[model samples]
Target: MTNLLDMRNLVAGYGYGPDIIHDFNLQIKKSEVKCIIGPNGAGKSTVLKAITGVLKPRSGAVEFEGKDIAGKEAYQIMRQGICFLPQERAIFPNMTVAENLKMGTYSLQDKRLAEERIHHAIETFPVLGERLHQLSGTLSGGQQQQLVYARAFAIQPKLMLIDEPSLGLAPALVEQTFQHIANIASSGIAVILVEQNAFRGLEAADYGVVMDLGKLVFEKPANEVLQDQRIRELYLGKAAKQ
Candidate 1:
């Protein structure tokens, strides 16, 4: 299958800082979900930043749909059908849920198409419809996450770069957040998920990518990664051996 996004030998860092990602490589096919898991400061989130143009790579290629997008602006990348959800909840806190959804379509040139997508997003997450007039910050954490997903859906992005979907969430909300990711992939959107919770993240992914100290460790089918004894011991901890 043709890859939707491909990164080769990416070396990226922020503002004269030492390189956070070194010679990183990755590829995702259309409609595939790939979860990136590693310890803190392993450059997992930095990979997402490089791909989404939040950090420009010092060398190497970031090819999306056959175009090199290494140094492109974030908005430019978004316009080319990539949506990025950072570690923080990306909603406009003071804005109404409806307004936040509208912001998702900012790059869309066709008004009618944008409205259609917004309607589709609401249908996909009915809770958003119910809270359309509510301030986004007032929603429960899970509800806020749903709004974020709804907004991304509204954009109809080909690829979604998600960093730490389960971060700072209640245990119950963590499960729900991964479910939202599954739903997104089911709709034919490719996703690169950087998650701290390896088990939960791998569970929702087609493939598992392991990283350490700014480099790729390995890539495997999710089930294999789950079952690999070394991965179990090193990343999943003692419970994984049981």
Candidate 2:
């Protein structure tokens, strides 16, 4: 595949074998921030799951870095330099912020190497460094989300799959969260960001793909797609500018 990620002719769904995502095709370049946006129940999250191996595609290929990764296990994908950060709150409530980040690198065989990555992660997220000793459960909602992201980064995956990054945060916090995601991409990691903040998601993405009833309705450069009236109406449920 010419892309870092290529999902072609993919059809996947939850158990019933009825594909919620049918005939989907998407390709993301290396080190790019690609965001998927659509209305609720539009199968946006499912696409992330499929890419992360949380849900297997019934047919078609999910190629990553030239290998077909379809049907592989989640941890296997992680080992191959891809990590998925779910929209759900995933922090260890009782663990200190630093401890949670440490847990992420537990599987690495090299302790010193792991520490090196941890140092990098903390430096990238200084707020996390400040909260090193604080219990994760006690942090603010945005802080908790940041912790989850920090933990994921500790694994040092080449690809990061993010789902609904701004789902429940206040508007101000949401902006901060998206800003962090942008930085993650800028740091040379390929990010597949699935978000409900369509306008902001589109703005943050290097490329944008619109989903409608589980199908990819359109894919275009972020700026160009945002200006497409039909794409906006189909997924945003609003009339677009002329």
- TM-score per candidate: 0.97, 0.92
Query: How many pairs collide in each candidate, listed in order?
Result: 0, 0
Q: What is the C-alpha lDDT of each candidate?
A: 0.92, 0.86
Which pairs, if any, clash in model 1? none
Would you list the clashing residue pairs of candidate 2? none
Q: List candidate 2 segments past 4 Å from native.
A: 237-242
lDDT of 2 by residue, 1-242 (tens): 36898899998899875679888888887898888988788889999899889998888899989998999998887778888889889889999998999988977999999999899889888988998999999999888988887887788778899998888889898888888787778889999888776778888888898888899987788988888777777655533533
Evaluate residue 174 in candidate 1 and report its C-alpha lDDT on the 0 to 100 scale. Answer: 85
Q: What ranges in model 1 sit over 4 Å off?
A: none
> Can you write out model 1's per-residue Cα lDDT over 1-242, one digit (the tens) per residue?
88899899999998989999889999999999999988889999989998888888899999999999999999999999999999988889999999999999998889999999999999999988998999999999889999998999999899999999998999998878888888899989999999888888899999999999999999999999999988988888755866
Give residue 45's error in model 2 in angstroms: 0.7
